[model samples]
Target: MKRRILVVDDQRHMANVIKFNLEKEDFEVILSHDGGDAIKKAFDCCPDLILLDIILPKKDGFQVLKEIRKKTITPVIIVTSQEDEEHKVQGLDLGADDYITKPFGIKELVARVKANLRRLEYLNLPKKSNIIASEDLVIDISKYEVKKDGQVINLTLREFELLKFLALRSEKVFSREQLLEEVWGYEHYGDIRTVDVTIRRLREKVENQSGKYKHILTKRGVGYYFRRI
Candidate 1:
């Protein structure tokens, strides 16, 4: 089945350009010009992925992203004109799987889209050992779900993948570059800060509020590892 992608941008020309290119890659594309409509189409169309613009009428991409995350874990890639780090961090913090600054190459954008989809595909595949457990934390690999103390924890695709990758290799430290290559599938095309942001987000969701359970630990200057509690 051809994957469906929702492209939300206020600029009609830019939206059409993206749509034209994505369709050539054999993806069914849906276009939305504003954030309000973007949110509605997201739920209604049930897209395999989303390419969202930060600036929009009636609502903004961050608000739309927040609403979508409340009920779904669909991969969202922020397409922004801002070159500032603050906006990029904000998007990631709000559960965006990835982001691309404006005036980007069509090829790069397509590559990122495919990479995000590939991660989703990997998550859906059957595993010989479908569960990874440590203390009260349980990661259901097959179902792509995580729970702590028997209560479900909401995780974005990136956060879940990072957690699973480190947990599967418990006690093994991996550098930010290695993790960007392995988890984000970006051997040469990502910021190191992305890993730190994702790790912080993952820790917030999986670790205990009282700071007793520290499944993911940083090794000072080395990197991060899962210290099975």
Candidate 2:
């Protein structure tokens, strides 16, 4: 099956150029010129990945990304001209998997896209017979799924990876920075409230069980750890 890529940029030529290259790689490319259009395209295409630009005529990439994250877990990479630390940080915090500064080499862009998509794929792949169960919770790595009291929990792509990593290394306190690299599979620094954000979200799905919450605790002044409930 061909991977579909949606390129959301206001620059027609730039969108076309990127589309051309992606199509060359046998990817089906979709194009949208503004944030509003980007959102619609995202829903319609259900792309394997999205290459979104920051500046747009309507809502802008940040707004577009917020909407995308709310509705879909599809991986999105912000393709932008902004190189400032704040800009990069903002995008990542907004749920973008990665960012590429403008004037980027096409080869590098493709490589980044491949890497992220691969990460996404690995994040979703179902685990086989790999099972780790306790009295209260069950983590099946082969199934790439989790259950607490026999109820399946819904976790975002990144959230699942974070939980999996912490569970595998239970009792170890991983700093925010270390978790960022291990779970994100990248070290694009600017700011990393993302690690904090994802952890909180994971708690909601995994640890914040209505009546019985399991491990996955926060170490004040340190980071996070997983232990028996």
Candidate 3:
């Protein structure tokens, strides 16, 4: 089946451009001009991925993202004109899969879409070991699920992959650049800051409220690693 994508943008031309480009790639594209409709379409269409614009009519992207996250783990890539680091961090913190600034090349946008979808595809495959357990944390590779203390933990595809890769090689440190290549499937030239953002988000999700991370540990100058139970 051709993958479906929801493109949410108030700008008609922008939305049309994305839709046209994505259709060329053989993806089924759905468009929503407002946040209200975007959230509705997200649940109704059950799209494989979403291209979400930060500024939209009715509710705005962040609100729509929060609503969508409350129900589904569908991958979301924030497309915005904003270039501020704070805005990017906010979107990532709210569970956005990726962030792309406006005036970006169409090919770059398409590449990011493919990359996020590719990760999702990789996550859906069957695995040999299937499950990795360490104390209260459990990672089910087959089901693509993670649980801490028997309670299901909601993780984005990238977050799950990062944790899985490190936990499988517990106590082994990986630099940000290495992690970008290994976990993100990006080259060494990829942004290392992305690794930091992802790590912060992962820590927020998996670590307890007290801020003690038992699973993912920071190596300070180096990078990060999963603790050996």
Candidate 4:
């Protein structure tokens, strides 16, 4: 299984340098000198990992990162010189798996790459086991699909996991902090707004008909629950 990596940097020398090392390690490398090219190559190659630089000719890394996320959660490591706290937080908020600063050691970069890839593989496991049917909805984890009242509902990887977590324990209340830990899989300091955003997105998909469902019920000032109503 050859791992494909997209290397996006405006600096040709830097891109070539990273490509040289990654290729030596048996990774299939795709190079893009600008953000636009990176996005194009990513859709075509579906790389296993993306090494993105913040400054680019066509668009900046943040824009590229946001767009990349819209398409796929392929493990992205921000390989750039942006060392500000805001930048790092923004990257994490955009759902980046990890962020690395410039002047990184080869060993450190490889380690971060390995860690992020491991996370993505586990999180994106096929969703088509058996149909997990509640009273009014069904989720096929292995098939990576979901439905409510027999209508297919498209879900991003995170939305799928969040819904599955709640559905598994309908009526079991979970705090926002608990959800961030259990579902999001990030035990570190993270914004609770992330939970809010994902929930809003899920409701948009699952609760389209008159906006009523007993699946996800929010507990004011406490947490949320999935009631079997």
Using TM-score as the measure, which candidate wins? 1
- Tens-digit lDDT string for candidate 1 (129-187): 67889998999887888999999999999999999899999999999999999999977
TM values, all candidates: 0.96, 0.73, 0.93, 0.65
lDDT of 4 by residue, 138-205 (tens): 88766767888898876655677788788778788899899887775555534466577667767777
* Candidate models: Cα lDDT each: 0.93, 0.80, 0.87, 0.76
Which residue ranges in model 4 land beyond 4 Å of their true spot? 7-31, 51-55, 59-116, 123-128, 209-213
Q: Residue 126: error of model 2 in Å?
A: 3.8
- Using lDDT as the measure, which candidate wins? 1
Q: Give the TM-score of candidate 2.
A: 0.73
Clashing residue pairs found in predicted model 1: none
Collision count for each candidate, in order: 0, 5, 0, 9
Lowest summed lDDT window (length 10), candidate 4: 184-193
Q: For residues 1-229, write the lDDT of model 2, one tens digit per residue.
A: 9989999999999999999999898899999998998999999879999999999998999999999998887888888897677777677667777778889888878877887777877866665687766566788887777897799876656676778888888889998988877776656542367677666666676665573446778889999998854
